[model samples]
Target: MASLVLTDGSQLTSDSQHLGMYSSPTASLVLTDSSQLTSDSQHLGMYSSPVASLVLTDGSQLTSDSQHLGIYSSPVASLVLTDISQLTYDSQHLADWCPLGKDTYFRKFEIYSMAWQNEINLDNVVLAAASYGGPVAVVRDRKRFIKVQTTGKPVISIYTASGRQMSSIVWTGGQIIHLGWSSTEDLLCVQNDGCVLAYDMFGTYLHTFGMGQEAKDTNIIEAKIFASVNGTGVVVLTSSYRFFLVNNVKEPKVRQLAEVAGLTVPPSSWCVISEDRHTRVLMARGSDLYLLKHSEQHAFPVGLDLRENTKSVVEMAVSHNNRHVALFTDLGHLWIGSADMRKKYCEFDTKCPSRPRQLVWCGTEAVVGHWDTVLLVVNRQGEFINYSYDSPVHLLPEMDGVRVLSAFTHEMIQKVPLVVQQIFRINSTEPGSYLLEASKQFQKRSHRSDEYIRLVKDQLNVAVRQCIDAAGYEFDPSNQMMLIRAAQFGKSFVPDIDSEPYVKMCRTLRVLNAGNNHTENLTCGAWCGLVKFGNFWYN
Candidate 1:
């Protein structure tokens, strides 16, 4: 019953009763026995060993071995696959949409008399850009004007939401020099010659003041007429050095606030009040920055001196948010600082690599256009995003893509996307030259697509002949998408076929092959054949 037989090699009887103790060579395999080997490692391709166990390189057993990497990823951060049919605007600089919501905020437009270039007279430059409520008034050349420049010229043009030129005003007299809009009554102030003209946005003449004054010893270089705090149709005047609270004595319908003087100290280049509607702080410019509070019908000056640098402020504007202030110096330095005007945040040397000019913050972003090309956006933290386009143009926001509103004077209107406006918004920080150059580069790249079409012409005959066969030439998967787009658009997509990349793409598409080998699914099939060579494509 327990017979044992051991010859030169190895043998076994089918029914040996004592076979349990008759041991043979012990296999080194650990995971599964030889009989279960197929089940244990069936996932392995082309197994070379007589016996082996499955173990992942990470020391863990893989549940499944079937996995292929996804085909697309974000061009920059994440992949956004847009359905080809849903493309819009063929935007050259299509960035992600800004997350800012729809809230009504004030946008200020400054009208500049760019007399440095072609000497366009200040009066002829229609300054009708800031009329959000009605045709805002403008002071330029020798006249205090209202609503100018419709189709052209020194005429004030009014605009409506329905793309209608609602109203306009034309003045044939005195050169206007300064203008301000009162948010309270929607009134406009036009200071020209030696008088100030006040009017409603509808070209309704309300009142006039300071008429025919003597031009001797009066250092009123810049002036703004604000509305009374009580809003009983009264006016308050502010100048470079003092505040004059005045009302229309002729109309008898005016009220006067407190006219305070001796508020501003000397050696100050520029001064402005805190833009806060309540608790407004009076700011004075001297060798140092000081805060002033208006109370008890008097200008009370505070003794806080914030001395940051020696550069003088030639031009300055506070943000509507009252968070930050921008300063431009005669040296062509664009400096940003806190709303308190205490500390300097950062400074950009905008002096033309040739000559320096002025800096103006047109509400949302800062622009330095007179000297060279520089557009800047300064955030509260003092960081900047700058985009520089190669032209001296003013930027205006085109809200609905239909109506173009000017920032200054709110007068001049254009149809096309204003290059000066949007391009400057893009240049918040120096995008280096590459991003700036890319806008132009896109056009060249689009033209080069034509070359791709011509190169594929020869390959197309063969590809259509065999709609299912493998592509003949060496295939590159990177051009797979380009080939697909080319096939879809055909000759229209690419007019030039002389480029090498196009030739390579055509060869990869198997456009040269004949017979039913070239299939509509040619991209997939071609990618599969090229996968052996480590090139892959995804639709």
Candidate 2:
């Protein structure tokens, strides 16, 4: 038998059967094992914790843990329920961990990781990344060998910043010579015949375009798809050693670039930087480099004072902004300077001829290049911050840092931001650093904490913002929590500063840490997803 119940006009029956269902005339009610509910869906609060607490729909919770401590919802999710017996880090602890260099502009640091050792064979992978902390795209490098050997079409996959698999697509179209991403996250697939196809993350074709009749007839030997303020752009190199350009993928405005004399071999490497007025392409030959500014089908040859034995360029990279350019030569020399070469920062040599597999700019502050598993993060000056990986590595450019991807783990190498340095560097003496120390001591009920607070009372607001910005740059979750808590503690003495920034940092870090958890649990294999995003302009 079955029985029905109502709200306020209901009969409470004990034994109608286990299959009984209940309903109210004016409200929609649901029943669980041990809890009762009301019809007001707008104020819903439900949970299954052993402590019998409730979590509201809007993410507020009234749990015993917080009530016992007499504190409201924490600004930080990770620090809310933490035990007091555990100590995360001292205010000065991070200074010893971050490395300092001769680059007076800023300090560089090797970020510790919440990374996982991957099972993928990254040596054969060609990688790309979306700008502003986007996903990484991994494709099998078909040009690594002289002979094309494969059982079937290669696999292209995408993964998040934390290495969680997003999607995998089998390459069933024409041979995939190169894979990149558009500003809006579409994967641009460039083929040998100058055909450019756009696909979503799952590899479903959206649109296609050609690189003009010249590229189709001569067949493209190499091509580069870069970012533009308007949209995605493309550049193609034909077997006949000529260059073709498309300003945007959406409009497909193809233009042929001027030839640089009787050159036959593909120039070592080249990059594009899109500007407000026009796009400029920078190409480097053995010992010479040329800047191709469209509008006058003429390539301007630029002279340089590269070091004696460091000519014969092999690889080159330009920063996300068109402000800086980097060049690598056969003599193991790296030239980093303003795009015009007017302000030469440094010309350091690696002293090896193996040629770096990749050279990329890290947030305009440094250049990151890698060979096999060895990566060197050289600031605009000569400070080299080297990181050794357990397996093959790939560098992905981001707005804040460079994402180092590998079969073993995914990591980030970036400059220790100025605000963070002020708060954590050894002997900083910055008010924010003093505030952090004060917060730690105050938690211990020491009078010394009051003295430290008085030192930074005038600049309490600035101290809070510095800690917030530094927390944004941190790679570790625990470190993020500690710094934020210190900021929260420091702000308590001052009321003029807003809490919104700290609140936002807490939520963003929480989301990032949650993503890290997913990355840690990734099982199966690397062929699951392909991810990459970048912005490009000709320089």
Candidate 3:
């Protein structure tokens, strides 16, 4: 007797003396046996015929019972066994806090286990993630070779940050140059011909706009989506070395920016900075940097007093707040300074001449650069930390931090809040730490609770505040609960302490935690709506 186990936990058993099986092109089968399957010379125990496809996924076994004949496959049959290491739960917690400078700490933590692990290769796709923990969009890169059954039009898929697929659409548009998310959570698809297509979260087509007649004639070679004072803005660089800007996607009035004079080729690096209710473009042409403003008819140079040995700028990234900018040069040096170029923070040499795959700010505190597998985070003072990944990763800059997306996991790296560091940092003694210890001991009904409480007796109010604030920053429910309990324990010892902040934090944490678990509830649009409601309520 022989048995066949399928992927869906179904089993097939054969009672005949000779067991033979065949699978179609779409079917899968697995055979397990400790001994050899002995069959007559005219019969075979298992035989896969022409055009049969057999796949062995993880934890599957295939063995022959008999030395005479165990399993046989025809020349047309395809047998494939995939070997992939299963990720452990402990891998998610491997990321820890690293101190950025004197008082600040940065942490990277896994937010979601990706859903498209085997379905999509991140290296071969164009990815865009919306801010405020919104949905992620992916489309296959047309230039890259991907193995697929069909050669038809590519499919665009939308997924939540946690990797749950939301929607997919058969893209019938022109060649896509870029994919980005707007401030309103609309997916923007930029085509090479300067047409921008907008789609809602569910992949429903909203509207389309064009850059300009000039852009269409010249052809858009590169594009950037940035947050402007008005709304989500788009700026495209044409092949003719010109730029076009639209301050808001909802009302895309294409305006040609002042051209970079004395430039015959595309700039090495460029970025958009939105400030003071206006948007400006900054571009690097060799060792020279130019600032192009829509209001000005000519581009003007922004002076950077570089050493004579400095090379041309290759990449630039602006902070989320638009207050700082980081520039990378061919000499392997990273320059951090104010956005206006008046103040210089520090210049650090990474000694890596190859341009990074992605360079963006991690919140307002550090500049993060990612190559193929190495991630480096450099602070304003030139302090740095390095992280290594085995797979291709993408970086999405957010208001508070940056989201790191890999095929297997989604993670957030950001500066840890001071309140959390005060309580959780390995320390000699912080009042909040003592308060936490007191709360734990009180739960155990130990006399040590009184000792811990007395240690922070004079600063019970401060300890309570710290615990409450720290609870608000923590993502873990257990940590939040323990901190809240610590706050409650300390609050009782303080006389006439206002309970408003603690109560408000509790309500906010409940809402935030629920949104974290159900990511669909806390998107950029949902957050904007909440802010509007809060304003109305306050008024």
Candidate 4:
């Protein structure tokens, strides 16, 4: 053995007999016997005799063999293993967490613009359209429609399922700016100038509410878009800062709500009624978000305080469950708040392009139309599931798959490292306690996927063995005899007798074949025995 003291007072001592070595002030020490040394950083007995030890300047040491470096540092400074996972063999159990797996949660949508200026042959164009229920509506009587209207002019039109124009209403008006349908398909509201024209489902004009009169002789300063709930009345906000709620059925109800003074609402500003028509929310030019309770006509101050910053609120929608409200700004940031406008949950950046024209929550996912180049689908947790939809596509299936994956991704971001430390840092003394904790996590992860379950089961089995070994317990014939009973109550990932892992685990338990009285793969009798073993272990 040789001992050396470095100029800096760090020392190394190795049980390496007569080993010739050299050292520098900054670099590591070099040694012979194919083992290199320099600093006295290596403690006595540092070398394993079969190989040489590497001593570093700061008293750290490394044991080198032909294949691996058993690194050990004296006064260890937080040893960081770089990509230890890659260094280990590809564990069948760990393969379930694929690093390059697809994202879960988001789905994309295709955008097709129906012609705003096109002339359809009268032979193809129909008239008098109506939607009965759901998103589908119908157009009828093509020839009679042509005679009643001017040829080749865009007037009133209903969009078809294929995104084509199903019908057009012939009119002298310049254009129809906005359209909305009622829940019962009984009425369609169209906005033009200062008037909101209500039509019966069959194209009969029911009523026209004049906004200028409602605002009391004020000039029609701007046209705020209107949203009408199917069974509820139409919600209208005028540029004159006047708002009105008008229901035009057999029982007509009109209520004049609060008005904003001295504020000019741009044409792009819009008001949307809640799905139940009991509430309405509006966004104006200054980024001011306002909520109104229609039932009581009481304004609830949301205090979003987002006005005058010049950022537009691009999209706003109530959640399907009607329990949440989601609003997206022009900056690709999503904000979620309570449906009742009470609390805001989270706001975070997204990969969606700024200034997306539309945001649609399609069931499990949200789709954003980012100009013509990209479509982004995002889940509530903000994972991009699918994109680049340029053709006829069904996005729901892909969204479902991504949502499942997001659950796993979330767990990885939150749990995996702690689990590894918990398992590997255990003492050789109390294996049973560690075994119990590992089992719980394993079962929880098992539901993530089939591959995940397999991986977890493998780790759990390993931990079980180590725990038994640490406690100095062994599975002998007597215990083996009762293994079948234990397994009956035992926690097992094995459900099939044909699976290799199941067979191996059963063999470990030494479960005997009750019918033949011979050791074999799990039959029904073996399973019963295994359950009992599980009960024994668990208890």
Candidate 5:
């Protein structure tokens, strides 16, 4: 008997010998014998010998050595076999990890290669990406001149995080100031006149709202869109330096915040902070900071002991949880402190006078600052890591991490989860590491698999739990399957272990993996449907 392997959606046919067929990881195999075709994992079709023919049109059949055949039918069933050799080594996943503090680590990895790399120019457009791996919207920046001349109206294009274009429309409204997405994934186009036009994902107009009469009269200077307790919120700063806030775009009830006293000019920088069930405005005036609230009659200055040479707070970002704040000053001093301004974490100097083009928080662990081509991540202890990109990048902060969107690629930079560190950290003695090793050796049919399994036999359940948890954090499908397979292997040794987590994780991964393929076409509601279907089928 001869063994044949099929991968990368290839086909194999042999009429001379009885063959044992296998499909490699992340690939599909198709085989035809005597005009009978069988499909298995992820479009995997296999034929056993020339003596027996198996035909599967709406159903699948498997034959054993005794010639016993079993038939299974599912309208939406798909299987994907895992090849351990294709699984990324722990070293590769660990390579990107950078230590944040004594125990914490962060890593940056590419998520998707932009599908619009050749069509869209990041330099000529203003882009905004939604949180939670949502769609991105981009429109031409009228202020930025491109070599090619075009019509007066620019087209607003919406794309998935993978850069697949969903829909686009020609701009026929007022001068656009910013492009953002609501919590429900609607496109919010903030115009210069303080009017925001909302559009669905398919570029259909939904509704519009205005900031206030004063904002429209004065003309909006700048605006910030933030996630609020109620929903997506927008705060606009008028040319007259007054601020207006709408805590929920869906409701669109605009309120004016307290005026910053003695402020005749625009502050160095400003941000919207949603705290204590109310949204407030925080602005930097020279070296002084003021927190403006809608309930208060006047804006109050936040006292801080600054260095004598400190000139201004150039940039600031509040963490996802609104628990920590990072403020960058004119003298290149970066300050990390509690959101309430009660406790100081640390202050580090970047030694660069130029203000960063974009400053945002990566989860609650670090502050990320992006210049033209330099991307920097600074932790609380002042330890920093910087990467230089060939082109400018946009940062979209998420609940767990930040998405770095560039002209050609989409990436994620975030603090590594502890479960992932336990399994992949170099020279780790954790039980999960042994279980992973055991899995790899088991695939190779090596006797060392037994030894590795024995080493962690006492803690098998712990190892299995770690693998399952780590698999949830991994973005790569192949890596996820690897960890999952290790957990499944470990579960076999623990007969009394609860299988709910393993089953749930497997179903969730399948749905997510399927969803990844059609992100451009699927909405949040569609995703929920897929998840519900998965749950129903599993139940």
Candidate 6:
């Protein structure tokens, strides 16, 4: 029997490491083990209490009292041993505080709101909300010093869906001519000096670029930002009345566009449309509209002419799909047509003779025209719906709807996607709705689940897909879980169903909810509550 002893609390041993011992009030060394120990005393004795020790054995004889195993009790002492979860939540019925319901079952969530009531003056605020539930970027009191320079600078603030301010950057730079968000969530601050600065989600300064030497040296008059396949693109009209394009923000690579012939000043209204891998600028000069592109600069033929009563275009907006457009004229004549102006959908008279404050597309189906406190949405059929906002307002067009931003509250005005309405609408015998009912019955352990499944067995995949998609539009974890559970339950009924879509949506909602669960950690971002209303009012 050999043993080693040390007084300086150091020792050396062979590979087997069998002849070392250490003792202390917190711990005491035992017999042979591969791990080496150093202490003032080296002697053979059993380990003491209070100091937890790691054990490695195949259910063999254990010598320590540290046998409790749980997430809280386990000490992270080994690389191989880690944490785990062992619970499964009941996700069938949605919990209280589910998303607000519009009409029968359309879900409308309170994505964001002002920190305080009437805190923001929407007239002075330049607001932009990125599509697909992206963050909103705001530049307060933006319409300041347009004619002349001022010492005041409006702060640039970015907020998430929960009204939590992700970042607030002091605007000490030049004149912020435009504040917009890129497709990748980078906030682009366009200055009058034609410098475009990019910032990340956390408000970190990315590099800066110029629209063009013509734009920078001669100065930019007006700018329009659009989303492109590669990155966010910007088109600027230089002081020389010439157009320039930065097709991709990442590389910047500026390209000057064809000039509109015989044009002396800026047009009344214009928009950038991206389609078929090509981008074009649609500008209206009085009643004559033109499409300016690298290939051609020609007069855009208005298929439905208002030649007798045509007035100057006041405001115009293109749909997100880049296929349709909404043109609001000074005479309150609103026209919905193709981007090329070749095919006209319908023409609706707003009956408000004055120019509209804002013109935007509502998910490619309707044209939203706002004048003062009254807002009107005229669909392609020329039928319209009116809305009222008592305060200053800004319109944010989305892939699904147009978001209305005022000083006190934020609301979305969108026609519910047809799939959502068909799936969850009351008394609907749609295949997707039946599948959801079947899943609910399955959760209750009723054999009716099988019967319901058999009814839609031919379209089970479509039904599962609809549930998965509806889950994305829901913010409430309980409601999201209910939709996802219905999807899962429906998936089990179809053996050949691809589980990838459902699994991906569940994972996405999990991550989204985890980040959105910051309600408890907020200092000023509060839950402004929700209103279950805004049923579809379409033609």
Candidate of highest lDDT = 3
Stretches of model 5 off by over 4 angstroms after superposition:
1-91, 518-539
Per-model TM-score versus the true fold: 0.40, 0.74, 0.78, 0.42, 0.79, 0.69
lDDT of 3 at 434: 76
**Which ten-residue region of model 2 has the weakest summed lDDT?**
523-532
Candidate 6 vs. true structure, TM-score: 0.69
**Candidate 3, position 145, lDDT:** 80
Instruction: Give model 2's clash tally.
Output: 23
The parts of candidate 1 lying over 4 Å away from their true place are 1-93, 96-128, 131-165, 172-175, 184-187, 192-196, 208-220, 225-241, 245-271, 274-286, 290-311, 330-332, 342-373, 388-539
| Model 2: residues with Cα > 4 Å off, grouped in runs | 1-100, 103-119, 144-150, 309-311, 510-539
Among all windows of 10 consecutive residues in model 3, the one with the lowest summed lDDT is 63-72
> TM-score winner among the candidates?
5
Span of ten consecutive residues with least summed lDDT in model 5: 66-75
Query: Local error of candidate 6 at 455, Å?
Result: 4.3
TM-score of 1: 0.40
Off by over 4 Å in 3: 1-95, 518-539
Model 1 per-residue lDDT tens digits across residues 298-370: 5444433333554444565554344556655546556676666567667766543333333334333332233
How do the residues 1-539 of candidate 6 rate in per-residue lDDT, one tens digit apiece?
22232222234434214422221223322222223445422332333122223322212222221111221111111111111122222231221111222332112234455553434456666777665445667776545544424555667777764455678787778888787878667889888888999887678898899876667788877888898767689988877887778888888888776667788877888889888778888887887777778665544434447636776887889887889988887777888888777788887777787887788887767778888998787777777667666778777777666777666666666665555556644334567777776776677687867877887889888888888877776555665666688888788777877788776666655555554553522211111111112111110
Model 5 per-residue lDDT tens digits across residues 348-398: 888887899888998778999988899889987788988889987888887
Candidate 1 or 4, higher lDDT? 4
- The residue-by-residue lDDT of candidate 3 on 398-468, one tens digit each, is 76678898999888888877666666554326788678767866886878689778888999988999898
Flag the better candidate by lDDT, 1 or 2.
Answer: 2
| Candidates, ranked, lDDT | 3, 5, 2, 6, 4, 1
- Which model, 1 or 3, shows the larger TM-score? 3
Residue range 1-539, candidate 2, lDDT tens digits: 22223222133234223211322222222222213333322132323211122211111222222211211111111112122233232332243343536423333333323233443566666877665445567887776763445677888877755565677778777777777888777888889889998876555679999999988888887888888777889998899978888988999988988778877888888888677747888888888888887576678898888988655888888887778889888888888988886788998877667788888887788888888768787887677767677667777776556666666555555565677656654345677776766776667676767877787889889878877777776655666776788799988888777888888778766655554454343221110011112121110
Ranking by TM-score: 5, 3, 2, 6, 4, 1
